[model samples]
Target chain A: MTQRISKYQRLKMMNPILQFFRFIYLSIKILIVVAGGHGGTRNIKSSTSSS
Target chain B: MAKIVVLGAGISGHVAASHLRRKLPKEHQVMVVSPNSNYQWIPSNIWVGIGRMKSKQILFPLAPLYKKKHIGFKQAKAVTFHPEGDVTENKPYVLVEGVVGDSKGKQEKVTYDYLINATGPKLNFEATEGLIPGTNSTYSVCTYTHADHAWEGLSALIADMKKGKKAKILIGTGHAKATCQGAAFEYILNVEQELRRHKVRDMAEVTWISNEYQLGDFGMDGMLLSYGDMTMKSHEMVEMIFEDRDIKWILGAGVQKIENGIAHYENLDGEKKSETYDFAMLIPSFSGHGFKAFDKNNKDITDKLFKGFMIVDANYSPKPYEEWSVQDWPETYQNPSYKNIFAPGIAFAPPHSISKPRKSKNGTEIFPAPPRTGMPSGITAKLVADNIIDTIKSGKEQLHHKGSMGNMGAACIASAGFGMTSGSGVSITTYPIVPDYEKYPKTQGRQLGKTFGEIGLAGHWLKLALHYAFIYKAKMKPFWWLIPE
Candidate 1:
């Protein structure tokens, strides 16, 4: 048997109406994460330095 | 005036070079030596492979951009590292060979006050028997040119399928130790969707083959992610996506060899099997460039400079997988033996595989090597550049700027299909690329909400947005530094 996908999951994926909302929600979520700054270098603690 | 040399102009080297040039004065020269004249936004190659985007749209000539920014550009490949220089050259220099134009085959000793070895992994197609791209019905999407050929093969197959001919398509890792399952995963989905778009979906059977023990190990031990209101394993999410798309999967498969239209593989159970396909897109194993190094006395010091890829200030001691700590990962990406040398991105050797190493019953190793591309490459390169800039300005060595895969995060937007309204994407954001079990033991080494997963058209839009954004950043357009690495 193949992996199961509930009708709700399918509707959430293919339904344009729900996807539009998803698009907005994801945009905000991702923007927050990106703005929160998950990247870039941090100052190394003296103890962590190998030099 | 210090001369900083960056080898390879991929994400890592390009980022390092750009930052160094932007931060340092014109007197302090920033040079990039690479065989590839054009700088490619590699993530978009997935779109190009599926005929959604053209190769030119994803890459631009590095020479013009570098010249405009006052950065020295050389279309050459590094042959050997003379970090301690040679008899005649008292200063540290790298031996390079020209790859194009009238300077082809000419060798030159390019000296540097500081060196950044960002020469990413060499795609080792030879590691697997008969796995050459564009031959034996096999293809690759690791580069723009390779993606072009893959699209040609795929489009032809689509045409054949439209003519009432049945076709079998295979896409995944080509070798037992190949990584980048994420790219192969994205490609398969795009191809499946393309088949549907061509109205020949019923005429072809598409398969997902990989070296991963589970469906979504992704070389990071399969994340535990927050999806909507529920918490789920990455494997479950992948299985749902695959099943919903009617995609067949063969996991724990180590592809050993390829024939004209057949792939020979060994599964985790130690059984040998062959899968036949009309078209295949397989990711080859990634290996070091086999660059040799010499000291001032001309003595071979390859071990001091390289452990497969360039050796950085990371713990390389042999230890059990259980005892592997996040601190084992390197922060500064500086080579211990050569203080002036650094390696970021796939150029530096990882402390160990994020995924637990596994072996088949017959002792054939079958697990994904750690992936160190895209976000990690850019972040690591920027950190390395910042530290070098500090060193140069202070007139002393500095290792202050630091980021490690253990503490850094990566957002992977895997485009499932290509379209404004009809496309799909599976977006995964994992914090601390390497799981820190000690810090967050409850959620399998990563923070739950931060290490989340989402599937929808939104992810596609995000992926497309990043394609343009990164291209803009790479081109160093107005205020490009505003874009985060």
Candidate 2:
């Protein structure tokens, strides 16, 4: 599964236009996460709660 | 209460100080002493140089942010280090001359339990006779002011091109030992893109000149990246790009000197040549920020540094390239002389050239010095901060972390323009920035599988995103710590 994903990623990178769209897609997803206030919270909860 | 003093508020020092303020107790103080009050996100200087972004857009005052984070801020330049207290005092303190604020130009002493020297490169424009900004033949994009000036020069060139006058633009490293070929590469491409945007590309002659043995060396030697079924070296990809873009290049050329629109350089063949240009943007070589250190007895320990870079964990055994080993690289950025002092980022002297050291037939060394840019510099800063925090807690240097460039990966997005749909950029990631021969024996010092590159509008977007994201993080917004280095 990991290799398949890697190969897919590599293929996406080979075409500049495709990669641009992929990045735009990824950027949109990231923007959505940021808007949802979950963009940088993976370890925030654990680290802050412990502190 | 232990007080930590961090000199310079660059990416490395600012990040280290921010982390320390968050992790350490209120009793233990974190103080940052820097000459500049505004933290300039330097990577975006390329955009600023091209006139797509303003200097004000990329700068944020450090005082307010540090105050909000409860970190002490001193706008001052560090003059000297007193590792062992002077005759009047017994505690280690740094002599600083205030550059801003109420105490501007005033001399004062600040004591520290731990010291982090993160004063970044001193732009040695004087190294070349005509490289200085106001009195120079060539311009630079290394700083916000310099970038603004470069944009002004570029605007004039563009104006000439529009008037049907052919413009020659020479862009690359100004010194034989200069690093940051990446910046020059981006600058030249962006200039070309700008020219095309104005329909004046045909009127402008773009040329790249560098000290690298080949194109895309980027000071980590050249990397090998996979492209579809075939693997390609960086030089091959760069050549293709240059050919497609109609850009001319001169590699393995050490820029000897520059005078009024004429740059004299020597190639690897020991052949000297000169190129005249209507405009040029040359990246100057870096040196230490000129700081002297002293022992308790007031004995000068200036030998602790070489060419202004603090010598760290590596064995300083001067050996030729044939005898260079991976162990010569510093695993931990701790200064051997002072356990409490750490020089992360470009402050630390690299062990040796990451690229295979090369020389002309006449024996003139022409290889570029290693570059410690964004990713590797940030990782090293975090590691150094963690180790310092541990040492403070245990009352001894108990924790150690290593983020050597030889075992690290870096991502670079070189922007060609700042447009939503019309712009383009190149994204590249290379593993173990310094090639590790032992781990990947077959790949000639690097892991070929982990290195790759791509170009598109998406790369431009990514670069733009990073510019904002890093500045937001540097300002210590909520959950900023979660942002990867």
Candidate 3:
């Protein structure tokens, strides 16, 4: 079955002006998520069991 | 002096060698042994498959870069693992066979103080009958050459469509347990847009066939994504995209064989079915290279080194799906038996698949294997390099540096179209790639805000920008280390 999407949402996805803002917004959001993942090593108790 | 050897020249191996060479002193040595002479930015292969980019634009020779960086390079493929010294050689070394030039077919024991097995999956196109690429109208995009062939086949089909010959196009997993659904997803979107660009949209029907039980399972059991002001399931987002583009889908399909222009598959219902297509590009199953390892006495000890892929510090106990935990994942990709050896990226076998296992009514297992590509590959490689550097300098065994998919994040930008202004992209950022039910306990075991999805032209821009950025980093350009994995 085909999915239903609001007409407004479809327009917004293609709107150059709105998409530019989305571009800026996504850039900042991704930067935050990616930065949080860096140097993300933690000291876990080494497992003893073998595969 | 210490000599570090890294196998394979893919993202993980290349990243590990680069970091090790940069961080370690000139006195120590860093060498890369790879069958491939060129380092290609794999993520950009999608663009090549759609004819938006060329193979040369995505690859560069590795010899010159290694020479300038003082990192040794060997154009050879590892044949056997000799973790312990043999009768003739007392040091831990790997037997590698040269692939080209005067050393072609020659075997040499490459010694190393520490070894990193980053050899990625072997594209098992043979697993599916009559699925050989460039034959029976089936194609692949797992490599640059494959992508080029796909584009050629597709362009020809597009030409036929423009001449009033209606066509059927199929894309998705070619095997019962294939991964890289995201790559196939990206390619389908690009192919759809390319058809529109060539003004043959109405002349061709595009369909997505996958082993996923539902749309957007993506081999990670899908995600609860925060899309703008709303929270939705990954399947919902994918369905909306496909619906808007008027694409058809076949789920729970285990493609068993391909014959001429027809694909035979068994569904979850155990019913046999077939789909006819004028052209197809399907991702094949990824399997281990079946590498054998031995001890100092030349006794066969392959089991100690491999269980399909290399054994790592993961809890690989046989357990049911509900009993699996993120803790079962590997933190340090070090081989337990040989502490001096490590297998990062796809080289390390996962304890279990992130997605729940499923079986066809006929008792055939069909589900996606875990994916260890792109971001995760780079991160794991860097961590392995850091731990090795620490161990070498401290003059002791060090397992300090660690990261796991259970806690690490990955950003996947699926390009729906290709262009600066008209292009569209679907961006999904998933934190702690493996679901942590105990930590989050809700929202599908992921932090909602961090695990978000967005669709717009910006996503395409980000993907293209990363294409150039990663190529620069791979070339070790000025201050390339400043870029994160």
Where model 2 places Cα greater than 4 Å from the true spot, the runs are: A1-17, A24-51, B134-137, B305-307
Indicate the residue-level lDDT of B341 in model 3: 96
What are the per-residue Cα lDDT tens digits for candidate 1 across B124-185?
A: 99999999999999999999999999999999999888889999999999999999999999
Clashing pairs in 3: none
For each candidate, give its TM-score against the true structure: 0.96, 0.91, 0.97
Candidate 2 chain B worst ten-residue window by lDDT: B398-407
Candidate 2 residue lDDT tens string, B55-163:
9989999989888888999999988889887998788899999986589889998999899888878888877667876344488988898889888888887888898
Task: Report every candidate's CA lDDT.
Answer: 0.90, 0.79, 0.90
Highest TM-score scorer? 3
For every candidate, the chain B TM-score is 0.99, 0.97, 0.99
Pairwise lDDT winner, candidates 1 and 2:
1
Indicate the residue-level lDDT of B91 in model 2.
Answer: 89
Which stretches of model 1 miss by more than 4 angstroms?
A: A1-3, A6-8, A14-28, A31-51
Q: TM-score: which is higher, 2 or 3?
A: 3
